[model samples]
Target: MKIYSKLTSLFIVVVLLGTLSMRPSEKKILIFFETKGYYHESIPTGVAAIQLMGQQNGFAVDTSRTSEIFTDEKLSIYDAVLFMSTTKDVLNEEEQNAFKRFIQKGKGFVGIHAATDTEYEWPWFNQLVGAYFKSHPKQQDAVLHIKDSKHPATKHLPKTWKRWDEWYNFKDIQPDLKVLITLDESSYTGGENGSNHPISWYHSFDGGRAFYTGLGHTHEAYSDPLFLKHVLGGINYAMGKK
Candidate 1:
């Protein structure tokens, strides 16, 4: 009986050791970059940057330009979905409905650049994106005022961040959004919203997390350490890990 007990203890110890050696399951993110309107030349750069971030950060990333992957079955495998400069009405009604269901199931969403220019006819999508892109003057330099430094997205940024990108004017801005960064209108040309213009924000909506950033029009934005950190933080926040 003593020998049997010793063997059992040894087996248990070996099992524990093996369990400790195994890695935790990695979180997965889907990067959807379909554009029915204006396509961004920076999309490939954005995707590559995100892939690098995932490789370094232990998350997995999958990119898609087709809306067929928006089905709940496919989307369920991802912890979060990122709209990387998606524009115009990219998804069909069925795909849109599936995406809506995915969010309602407490998944996550991260919108970069022209994601606001997507799904104009879908009110739910509009609210999910937080606002719609009205127009932009041109790609230029602007100063971003950190509104909520406590947020994971803006916390790494200085109080005043200067960068060059295409700045967008927004319409139907959601009143309940937790603004993380605002545009300093005086620092740039073609300001429309004046002092109240939000450049980045995050909020909990419809049983899920949503984060949006108006930056990333320029390829260089993806390569900048500060901007990459900012985007990674937003991704983390949306994944509910921040």
Candidate 2:
């Protein structure tokens, strides 16, 4: 009887260990949409699209508009942080410090359109975003030139993709960035960056990965398969999955 009890206990331990070993690691993302300046009307559509992507891709997403979730304990729970069209100064000094620490700990960051328009006073934040939104022409159709076809973000896109959105002219463009897409100034008027205008880029910053795209300004962009693929690739790249 004692031998039987011991055998049962050992079986239970083995089963528990097997279950633990078979469990997959969870991937979680935080989508922060706080805007202090001009808010995009497409913000809700963007959030919903991202949530759907997360659901389909087997990752978890949490949305927040408040800076209170920027603490170390809170930020630590997410594998990646995405700024879904966030603008202006959104975090206080303490929260900013916590976010800096979070990035330094090797997490990921994904920024959509107008994220570059944020935190002009914080140099570190600007550097992480890769560029600042200098100005933009009216929303119009433009040709996107794929610079890096091998990049996950541009792999599925054509060499010359045509899309319409609020086209931004960036200032303080990071010289070391791996640009994935550039805009052909000839295809659109009011382009201020001349011929070598970059529209999407990614790079490793500090101790973390950062990806930004000057896309997703219009509600229709979220539903476009190619655009969705582009955003998904950025998200995957930021999460270190691509």
Candidate 3:
């Protein structure tokens, strides 16, 4: 009996040590860039950029250009869904319903650049993105007016950021979104939205969180440290992090 009791105690100690050494599960995000309309040439670059961000920030990242991954089974592993320049109607009705359910279950979403150009008929998507793409002139240098500078996504940004990229005009702008940054129309041209052109925003939708930024359109954007931080901040925000 004494020998048996000693062996049992040793086994329990080993088990406890093993359990204590186990690492916590990593947070995962899916970067979906399916475009049923115009595809951006910078999609690959953007994917690499986001994957690097995940690596440095201690999160798992997956990329998919197909809408077939929208099933509940596949999406179950992800804490958030990021649309990196997805354009037009990429998801069918069934997939759309599944995505809606995913967000409704308290998942998160992050949109980038031309993500606002997607899903014009989907009201839920419009509200989630805060706007729909309308038009823009040629790419040129412009100043960004930081509206809410305290947001994790915009806090590092300059009060008046000057950069050259393809700017976009928007339609169906939702009032519920917390605008983070706006374009200073007078700094450049193609001033469609005039004094109220919001380029970045975030808001809570349904039971989930959503963040969108319209600042990453060029290949150079993926390499910019500030722009990368902006994207990372938005991603973290959507995932309910800082």
lDDT of 2 at 81: 97
| Candidate 1 local lDDT, 169-224, one digit each (tens) | 99999998999999999999998998889989999999999999999999899889
Give a tens-digit lDDT track for model 2, residues 51-116: 999999988999999989999999998988999999999999999999999999989999999999
List the candidate 3 regions with Cα displacement exceeding 4 Å: 1-24
Alpha-carbon RMSD, each predicted model:
2.8, 2.5, 2.9
How many residue pairs clash (N, CA or C atoms closer than 3 angstroms) in each of the candidate models, in the order given? Answer: 0, 0, 0
Candidate numbers sorted by lDDT from highest down: 2, 1, 3
CA displacement after TM-score superposition, residue 65 of candidate 3 (Å):
0.6
Candidate 3 structure, TM-score to reference:
0.92
Q: List the residue pairs that clash in candidate 2.
A: none
Candidate maximizing lDDT: 2
> Lowest summed-lDDT stretch of 10 residues in model 2?
233-242
Total clashing pairs in model 2: 0
What would the TM-score be for candidate 2 when compared with the true structure?
0.93
Candidate lDDT values, in order: 0.92, 0.94, 0.92
Give the local distance difference test score of model 2: 0.94
